[model samples]
Target: MLVAAGVVIAALTGSAGCYTDPGYKGRPSDAWIAQLAAPGLDGRLDAAAALGEVLRLQPNAPKVVTALVAALADTSDPVRVAAASAIRHAGRGGGRVREQLQRDAVPAVAALLADSAHPVVRTQAVAVLRDFGPDAAPTSAPALAGALSDPDPFVRRPAAEALGALGEAAQLVAASLARAATRDGDFRVRRAAAHALALVGGPPGTVGPALVGALRDTVELVREAAAEGMGQRGADGLSEWTVPAAAGAGDPMAMLRATATADPNPRVRIAAVTALGLVGDRASRPALRQALADRDATVRREAEHALSALHRRGGQDPGMEEPSRADLCRSNPGGPGC
Candidate 1:
């Protein structure tokens, strides 16, 4: 084994020479690559971690990406976990590296998502897929959707969460998420499903009704996620409460107000305040003002920020318009209003 390591190191530094990034002070010796395939678990695990650092130092190198791709199938659980982590580092660059991940590394990681015996591997695999962005469709969407059915919450949570990252491609699985949001046994899975639904977006009629139903989930966290999804309906003019009208006064604006003002969980109140700002609902001002005194400092701060955003928008209204730098600076990232 020692002689084999020496031979491998020699090759890395030979005519074909090792690849090195600006931060990489030395060539990535083949010994590290060999360790990746070594019989000892620690050697393989350490190799995966070392490769992660190499990728960080010299990102977008296809050679390392190929090596890490092979590591994804390592029988040792730790090595697979480490390899998944390293894949993220290798695939960080948007162009070539992302393309490499899409072609080489990503498929291997996607395969791991179905490994029901190891939930951590699935979670790490989801992390890698999250970077695929919208282009992840035609493949990752279905794979991620399938993960939502995994028995382990650790696996199901990320699968449900990754679907939202697909953007419009999420439409492929939006109905599935709607079902998961309402019926998943675990509160975390349901909460994640509800939150993901907001990002995937759909006709307010279909998506909105599903999310509203979640708002009344016995679990307060699920309700918080449902409240958040309504605010994120973007600029669409759809009513957020039509589906739940029969259930009672399901006006989302009203629900946001109620949750912001009365939920026992301070964290949920904090999310409610942030959502009010995103929804641009000026009518929520009174409840938000009351939230200004919330026991949780985070809730108080979110309330204040929401009020400021509302105030800025109000200044933009026709008759109430002002030339104050506040709203103007909002259009631009930094200025006097900032």
Candidate 2:
């Protein structure tokens, strides 16, 4: 083994004379190639660094990608690190590298996602799946949804975030977020679900309820995300919120108004009001008018204007209008509004 290492090294450094030793798996030429490819040695930063350069120099090399994928199977930390970096590099460039990532065994990829002890490796694995995007189609969604239950947010957050990029995967993962928002123990997971919901933006049936529920979430960040997600779902369905007949008297707007008016976190309260506007109904007049009296001056002004628009349109309105920047800001402060 020592002699083999020496021969590989000698060929890499170009010290071997012109020779054909059949016994050497790696001839002098192979050594130079290996050196250029520069697979990292046992648990050393430099080896990982050199392997990174090799990936850059030969981005299209199938052997290098395969070798890196194989490295993940090793118990050696250094080799696994180098391998992870190499796969990440390949994944970023797409094309052949992306294909390779998709073909990699589930357990190998799952190991990288599940093992939180190595944040760098776990992040890389999630990133690879993210970059794979459409190419990852079928597998990406399932892998990410599964990761939502991971022991670590470092892994789970990225997985949730990655799902946002999967377009078609949105519907499938929406169920997971719906479930997670209600049951996940970590505040961060709930927050991640809200963020993922924003990325998977769609119609009212798909995003509205989840977002509305998020407004009432115990965590402030999740509430913020829910508000943002609603805005991203477009400004159509929520237009009637400013009218008297909108969403009916028992509409969820009442809940949003209560939160907007009195939530402990000023931001969450603001988000609640903005959500009400997005779901605009004439019946919201009393609530929005009540908001005008809010100590938060921003909420007061917006409430007055949203009421004005709803009253002007009456019942024949298109149920969709671009909310003025001033009005949106009043409800959400810095939030992304209609």
Candidate 3:
């Protein structure tokens, strides 16, 4: 009986040793927190990673939030990266916890955006700001705008996306976003900037010109994004673009009409057609009609939908003649309008 009891006791001890608690009940153990300050890199890395898991399980813990915020400024880039990423994960928690995490960690994470020595750290920092959503905007926008100039396209892309996530609160940086949309070296950065510009771009006047200009970008994606942004900007956004050719704003309507009817990529044409349908009036019928005959069936389908939308709005104008094909060609020489 004694031998049997010993075996049962040993089995219970072995199972207890093997049992891994999925997470902490409240604050993590002090030993785990101390590991974050351990002398060796591996020890600190492991601790930071473990804390991320802890955050996943106990996302509202103030102690874990404090430890991770401190880790954002750690001596090692990987540790800082892990901390920023962990904070971003934690920002996904329930309402009060997400708000608290953003309030506590935004400044620290925003500071990392300037860590030029480590682009990966900056990238992760923007991601945290991005995940925090609009709440992080007021404090983090300027830093994110600064990141648009980072030498890395990867960093710039997410920074633009983060600013976009901030929505209208990020209006102060509209000019910066405009510059990135029209002039950034990378197509991906340019695309992201254009998408963001549509959201936080303030008024049509501030962002319209840049988005219209982006329609001329060599990359089809950039042009498509520009077209979509114009559509999102609505009537006021397209007001400047739709003026008669003689108004001397360089005939933006003609350009948009040309894009709708003649852009080489069917996706771009579809986007342009959609934009014209949303904002276009009687003057845009010619381009929409031309799109109806596009080689791509999708463009034709979008054109059909656009025409229906136009009819629903009672968009026809008695005074404005549908520009003749010859006139369209004259306004945009060598385009589908021609």
Candidate 4:
């Protein structure tokens, strides 16, 4: 067992200096391992990063496990996220590590689930937590449900995905997700809620109506999710809302023109203009023509290009009929986009 443990230690540590003695003369000490496991916050991201490296290197080390549990219990959010990730690796067997985490009751990990300020981190944390499976303690259920309403698309999306892992608790989460689908400020959040509903693995025929209602969502992403879900259930007669572009508020063509004419969030504006060409809403010509004159080069280009595409295609954009084969993946805006 010691030899096997040593081999695992070597495999885990690899090139890290933690495997060797301070002067390359003796076995690594508990003190050294503990130091590497300590969570650092006081603007010492490097220190936390180093500790994470050490934990990653020694998945089965009792000392490493002890240090990680301590880190998971730390007050610092970043440190907690690191420890949770490290523990996830150790717990790949799916029982002891999860039990340890549940017993720790670290709020930092929960708080990280709602950290919209950093969307990427929030998404990644949610993804890791969901792997804990249906047996995850009930104490964390409310926290996961609350995240369904997160402001950041990346944060809320993953929260939806995580809720799916809760098994029976998923019914409770579905209520929260439903509320978010209709009321959340971010369209992406609503879409995530809708997608998460499907992932519950319940009766598809019964859930179809709720998903169909989401088709009317103001944001394209939500509409897309709804449309895709409806398509999967073989529901037809989805009028007004059709491939690529769906009508809202007024005539489909007119709405597209106005959307292209106005609407903040440059990406949304651009997508709206593109939708006009796909829908072949000719009534929007005036708006599209004017959009071609806008100062923003991309918007102008999209407007002109879309107008040309519409004219050539004779209305109605192509390839809007497909639905995703799998459930919606939680948003992940790691790095800058988050």
Candidate 5:
């Protein structure tokens, strides 16, 4: 049997031991490129592994990148998987090399999301898209958005996560993500979607309600992610939350406060307390103060930070100097205080 399986495993996962073809030792990049087109699965797998090694040493090698991009479409699944893995490795760092891959390889890898028959290949394809982050957003977002509805949760979770990695560029698909967050059968997918909704900056009118609904998920991690997303959206985002009356009466801050005080999970409580600091006004101080007495030390610590933020927003910092009379007079003129 070809060592192609080992190469695929090691390339997909970093834990496997290294595998090298002794015959190709000391071969030049051109030699590996040629071998990629050679007959049989063994030769192609070896070439894919060698090119990945070259990429690790010289990430900017144009010939190696070109060869790998071509290999992504190879008829053999192993070769394609290995090729995607190699491209993923080259994209681990940000610079000219990764930028080149973004322009060259993203579309090809994205095609695999829709065309590949194997779920593993599709999963690896999503991983490559994610490794490119925001740079891959323009080409990869639509494909990734479609992958959210895939039957496999393995693919769905990563697709949601990849969209999250796209950041604000993914706003166009915010509604799709909101649906996944609220209705996905898998909690892992739901958690990833919740986190993505926070980063993707969809219409807060849509995203805010989805996240609030997620707070009631049966899974604690999903609830925790929703609370964290609330904090990430901050005050401006929170202002647009238009949930129905049955769902906290459209008041996200109140919902966060209730979660901080009542959630069974300490991590969820911590996230809720932290969110209050980011979105809450001076009125949130009472809830934060109450959180300071919680059993979990982290929740109490986050509560302290939230209280500090509230104090700073209200201009109550202990080190703040009182406004000067001249300064007040220049601004107020006809008013009692400036």
Candidate 6:
């Protein structure tokens, strides 16, 4: 039993030091690029490794990224892997570093994703594409969506994430993602595809009703993500979903209230409450008030906060049984309402 438990623990949560990503060590000299460009193999190898670590830290300098992109072509496998690692780190800032990477590094790194010989090289290259978000969509989405069918869920999961980052521009792969979200054998791939669809095609009229449909997913995380997507796109109206007839009210608020008060998972309930708050309509007050007595303390607290916001918004019944702002502050003390 002890050995079984230990293995489960290690499998679920890897041991320490796993948090630190592998990359080049040491700071880059101003002439680090020149060193990589230098004639000697030793100098170039050392420079590539150091720059890979620097890129792991995500330095936003244009020249540094430009130089790193140049390293992607080096004949040495270490240099190519290190450069890919750095390029992955370099895209976090979302501006010039991202643009430079999109222009110069994406093609090389993406090509490395198919390297066959170096799997980590491919994984690191995929990691780099994650930072590109929507900018890499045109060049990156098709390949990423294609990976959704990979035998390894590990590869499929990150590909879904990158596609999700592409957001609306990932319209081209919406059908593929919808298929993966529902039919994929791996739970992680199903969860990731469900999540990616929320971002890629969840809006009311975009590509399809995949996000709303995800609300019924067997996976708890997928359902939670779907609720969040509905909330984000709910705006002044919840065109993404219609209130279920069983909820007895012909509005999304009815469905939200049902999901909030009755959903089994606390996270889904919390997301439903958050969506109500985001909707910020007077109709939500009754549900928020009902949620005040919810089984989960967090749900109760969230209900209090939502009611407070509703009061502030001049809800349907200011004079009803709703608590005043001061009362809410005392109830959930230290809340933003205070």
Residues 1-338 of candidate 2: C-alpha lDDT, one tens digit per residue: 00110111111122222322221222322342354344444333344445455556545444545545555655555555565665666654455444555666233554566555666666666776676666565766776787788777777777777776675456666777666665678777777777676556544454555655666788888887665554344345353222234434223345566666777776766665665565555555666666767888766665655665564456433444445677655544655553
For each candidate in turn, the TM-score is 0.71, 0.63, 0.78, 0.49, 0.78, 0.67
Relative to the true structure, candidate 2 reaches a TM of: 0.63
How much is the lDDT of residue 334 in candidate 6? 81
Best by lDDT: 5
Estimate the overall C-alpha local distance difference test score of candidate 2.
0.57
lDDT (C-alpha, whole model) for all candidates: 0.72, 0.57, 0.74, 0.51, 0.76, 0.66
Across 184-278, the per-residue lDDT of candidate 1 in tens digits comes to: 99999999998888667665566766776676688988988877765676435334333445555445556668789888988778778888877
Point out where model 4 deviates above 4 Å.
1-29, 36-51, 54-58, 73-78, 105-108, 111-124, 137-139, 165-169, 201-209, 227-338
Indicate the residue-level lDDT of 226 in model 4.
Answer: 42
What is the RMSD of candidate 4? Answer: 13.2
The candidate scoring highest on TM-score is 5
lDDT, residue 222, candidate 4: 68
Q: Rank candidates, lDDT, best first.
A: 5, 3, 1, 6, 2, 4
Model 4's lDDT to the true fold?
0.51
lDDT by residue (1-338, candidate 6, tens digit) is 00110111111122111233333444344567678778787888778767766665645555656666777666667776676676666766455555566766776666655555555555666777776667677777776777777666788888887787787778788887877877788877777787777566633333234554556667888777756755664453454344445534434446567778888999998988877877676777777777878899999887777777677677446546757667777656786757
Note the residue pairs that clash in candidate 5: none
Which digits, one per residue and each the tens of the lDDT, describe model 3 over residues 1-338? 00110111111122112323345435454556678877889988888888888877666555566677777768888888887787766765665555556666887888887677788888888888887777677888998999999999999999998898787789888889989999999999999898788667564555656766787889999988877876766675454344445545445556678899989998999998988887755678878888879999888877776765665467443543454556545434675635
Per-residue lDDT value at 294 in model 3: 95
For candidate 5, write residues 1-338 as lDDT tens digits: 11121111111221222323223368887789889978878999999998888777666565577778878778788898899999877775355556567766888888787753678888998998888777568788888998998889999999998898787888888888999999999999999998888767677578767777788788999989878877886776654554455665445556678888889999999998988888866667777778979999999878876775565467763443444555445434553553
1-338 per-residue lDDT for model 4 (tens digits): 00110111211232222332221113353544445444436433334444445545544343454455455445455665665576566544324433444544233455556545555556655765676566553655567788776666667767775765564456645567666666677777778676565444233333434454564456767655543333232212223223233323323224345556675545545765665555554556677778877767777877766566554445433422221222111111232222
Against the true structure, candidate 1 reaches a TM-score of: 0.71
In model 4, what is the error at residue 71, expressed in angstroms? 2.2
Ranking by TM-score: 5, 3, 1, 6, 2, 4
